[model samples]
Target: MGSAVSLRRFPSPEERPAALRVCRLPGVYAPQADTRLLVAQVRHEALWPGVRSLDLCTGTGIVAVAAALRGARATAVDVSRAAVAASRLNALLHGCRIRVLRGDLDGPVGRERFDLVTVNPPYVPSQDARAPSRGARRSWDAGRDGRLLLDRICVRAPGLLTPSGVLLLVQSSLSGVAATLDALGRGGLRTRVVERRTEPFGPVMSARAEWFAALGLIAPGAWTEELVVIRACRS
Candidate 1:
């Protein structure tokens, strides 16, 4: 696409009120500072023109639109029906062709290999039913240890990639970044951080720590909020 634009903006935590701007989609989700960072990261990458691209957990299809704007044939997938609908609508709004599919990770795009795959999977660890935002519950929560979906993606990724394909994923250090790297390695993928940032912990993280303590899984002062974006390729 055009030169990548930086979406990262600093608003004081209190000033960073969640705003409702229409995404490239139907319904609304909280668009935070990190979302912009993600868009910029993808824009800076060397995307092969006219190559096929896949956006896992496509949500509002922002990433897919970016890919299409860059001339790649993009497909976006999400487990939530609303997200799928939103993505399609957003693609239309952007005047870009981004195929939307409803299914987990690679489920809907069966046997379809792509030159690039991008995902912004949920990376929060929480057991509090109320901790997640409506969108976060569906798109952000990664179960108890926060590796639920990430683990699955790593295992399934190699099979989904073209011989030269790469995966770009965003995850929280609070969810254990090192462990995630290990998981990818076990799946025969080599990974490197493309971006790193510190954000405040959301409610889910507090709940996760409490639950962990209750179950003797950790001592106090062990968890904090930090996120990292990683680029992975088959080893």
Candidate 2:
């Protein structure tokens, strides 16, 4: 609600006074640091009427609901059926009208463009190489080097935007921040980091810390991870 946001430091999620209604599926993704940080950034935007916002990887529809709360028409997409159900329920509970769809990233919004697209896809370095087809791993498992879905999103998501539309994507710095910027930039969008934040390694990251450490992705004793929100816009 001010002027422009700062980029040279870790961005904190703007604290809200009242908690909103949220539901979660067991073993499914629940909103965490990345979620809160992304939500905070979305709130700072001037979401005027008719600004359509799409939330990709909307585990519980929290980000979409936040956009709707800020007066933007919102849509949420996810591949997990449980996630889709959870998102719909949360939207209803929050009194926000949201179209929740159950399908892979680009399928639900085929040929439909939005003014703003929000993404919080899996970026954690995981063990699985093949794409996760089900279970909780679907939310976190990315192929080695951790750019599996990130690459796909960077390539496909931009095409799903209206002219002058914006893409707000959140991922751990470990997934190659520069690569993301380059991918989007090469794809013809002006990109920049709008927000950043750090949190101690969550359980998933902690478990794989040793693997990544061996590969020199993380320090031997590193216990925290940095997250960045990249804002890409088409003019």
Candidate 3:
């Protein structure tokens, strides 16, 4: 086991006004730049009028609320009760009818399918054994190799999607974007990068260099972290 990584507490809606609130609250990990970028991409490229959508791991329900704002009936899910509560409150605050559920990825939505599914799961690859803070544990830790949640989501996505439905997911460059794409492909879904951003701070940047070094994917030095927006559909 390795030393525990310190994590930042998730911000609350009170900390930021609703009008300017772009991420979820009461969770350790706030929405990253990738999240906002992906939302914009989905809004511009994929969303259609009256489409039903699912937001997997919806933290503050920002994605679900955005989808509803765009005329997509939306449902948001998260494993943390606090997250579900925050999402529900946020939805109500926005006067949107987004449904909120508490369960692991895909557990809350169960068998029901949607025209679109979006996920912004924890993608940090760490060997830390210390129990993370509530928000960190649920929203930041991505297992020893960072693909734990991503793998599960991709494997189950095929069943949750409507025949022509698409999945939009965000992953960090530190997690090996190419490997993630390959994993999605093996799960029978084709992928493409719809968005990318380089950030210098946050929990992701902390162990990024070390992780990348061990993986031998990039040379040791200051490297930019990329947010990959992957679009996948049933073939």
Return whichever of 2 and 3 wins on lDDT.
Answer: 2
Error of 1 at 129 (Å): 10
TM-score of 2: 0.92
Candidate 2 local lDDT, 56-169, one digit each (tens): 999888889889988898999999988898888788777879999989897977899998899999888777777788878889878887899999999997788999788999
Q: Could you tell me the lDDT of residue 17 within candidate 3?
A: 33
| Predicted structure 1: clash tally | 4
Q: lDDT scores for all predictions?
A: 0.71, 0.84, 0.72
Clash totals, every prediction: 4, 1, 2
User: What lDDT score is found at residue 38 in candidate 3?
Assistant: 57
Worst 10 residues of 1 by lDDT: 1-10
What C-alpha lDDT, on a 0 to 100 scale, does residue 234 get in candidate 1? 74
Off by over 4 Å in 2: 1-12
Q: For model 3, where is the 10-residue window of minimal lDDT? A: 1-10
Question: For residues 80-167, what per-residue lDDT tens digits would candidate 3 score against the true structure?
Answer: 8767877776677667798888888888776899988999987876676332446456586776667778778878888888988888
Q: TM-scores, in order shown?
A: 0.78, 0.92, 0.82
- Could you tell me how far off, in angstroms, the CA of residue 213 lies in candidate 3 after the best superposition? 3.2
RMSD to truth, every model:
7.0, 7.3, 5.9
Candidate 3 TM-score, C-alpha based: 0.82
